[model samples]
Target: MAAPMKFHSLADKIVRTRVSSTLNKDVKQFGKKHLFDGDEETCWNSDQGSPQWIILEFSESLSVSQLDIQFQGGFVGKSCWVEAVKSGEESFARIHSFFPQDINQTQVFPLPDTDSTLTSLKIVFDSSTDFFGRITIYKLDVLGAS
Candidate 1:
């Protein structure tokens, strides 16, 4: 059997910042404060309810084996969608989506094969009620590759 691919931390791979709120001066300023050079920004209405998202972009290609999403509170929707994109030009593809029963709790998602390369990462909100109201993520850790 092939040995497991090595994993790396995404602590330094943050390349851009995106939120679900209206793009006002505050949001733009927030982007300027968090996003890196050549990063993209966008917003989406939550079909479920009030939505929140944290999008990250890696600087280099790496083998992603696991993903750790650390947030302050829990979500209200039935499930959340995690997406990845190979390049800024490519459209985001769904990686994982699931419902959580807990609130105000930290969540961890173990990814599938996910050998695919990613330049950007996004967390989608899917809920009926705005439990958290807005998704706020403190940090994201992508495991695999340096």
Candidate 2:
């Protein structure tokens, strides 16, 4: 008999580690927690600036295979890069890069499979909308196995 498959989301099982970033203090409602709460209406918005980022750390290594993200309209990540740190690694290494379109929709990115597992993931925003430079993320899902 074939066993049914199980799925897990690293975003949903994030470690207690705090997320750090430079965000607009005024937009308190749109905080980091909103990014992984599985709500499409809520989002995380950063302050108008360059080099904004958010890092998610997990308690253990995760065999991540895909990453899904939703960005807010008008306030999107124009130039961004994704990085991951494998278990036992002290630093993160670049994994992917792309220019997110200015629209309200979810984007799925397939990550290359690796023999090792990752302990942390980082997303860096080098630039954003022409007017605000703010980065608004509606949702983030990290799909993988333990």
Candidate 3:
């Protein structure tokens, strides 16, 4: 078996965040906050269908170096991309794109070392596996420095 990848976060900072789609109100306990709650069992599940997203806004610009994501089995995002808006930019620029395997695991991807001042980060889920086309994210972590 292959060993999993590991990364030491550059900065342990948390920021204000929001999601594009959340599960129905019926599952009140399962909200977007679960993405950063440090619990593997707790997750933020999209209502239904694809094209869901999550946005993280920071009080100050950060020089992000990497990102780590954990997705739930079956409900994993089949295709996704990451975008960022610099301190003064009104629009987001594509930073990274990925196609994750259909499994429950943590995957870390290295970001460009451009040293840009990023004020916001957006993760877009273009599609998901079967099961109502919902995307379930267990955790999302951004690593970098201010």
Per-candidate clashes come to 6, 0, 0
Best by lDDT: 3
Q: Give the TM-score of candidate 3.
A: 0.85
- Residues 21-89 of candidate 1 have per-residue lDDT tens digits of 533345444432432222223222222235556566677754466665444344344467788886434
Model 1 misplacement above 4 A = 1-6, 22-49, 74-77, 87-89, 128-132
TM-score of predicted structure 2 = 0.84
Off by over 4 Å in 3: 1-12
Count: clashes, candidate 1: 6
**What are the lDDT figures for the candidates, one per model?**
0.55, 0.77, 0.79
Total colliding residue pairs, candidate 3: 0
The C-alpha RMSD in Å for every predicted model, in order, reads: 6.6, 3.0, 4.5
**Most accurate candidate by TM-score:** 3
* Candidate 2 per-residue lDDT over residues 27-142, each given as its tens digit: 46878878888877788877777777888888778888777889888877788888889888889999878777787878877777767888888888788885767788888888
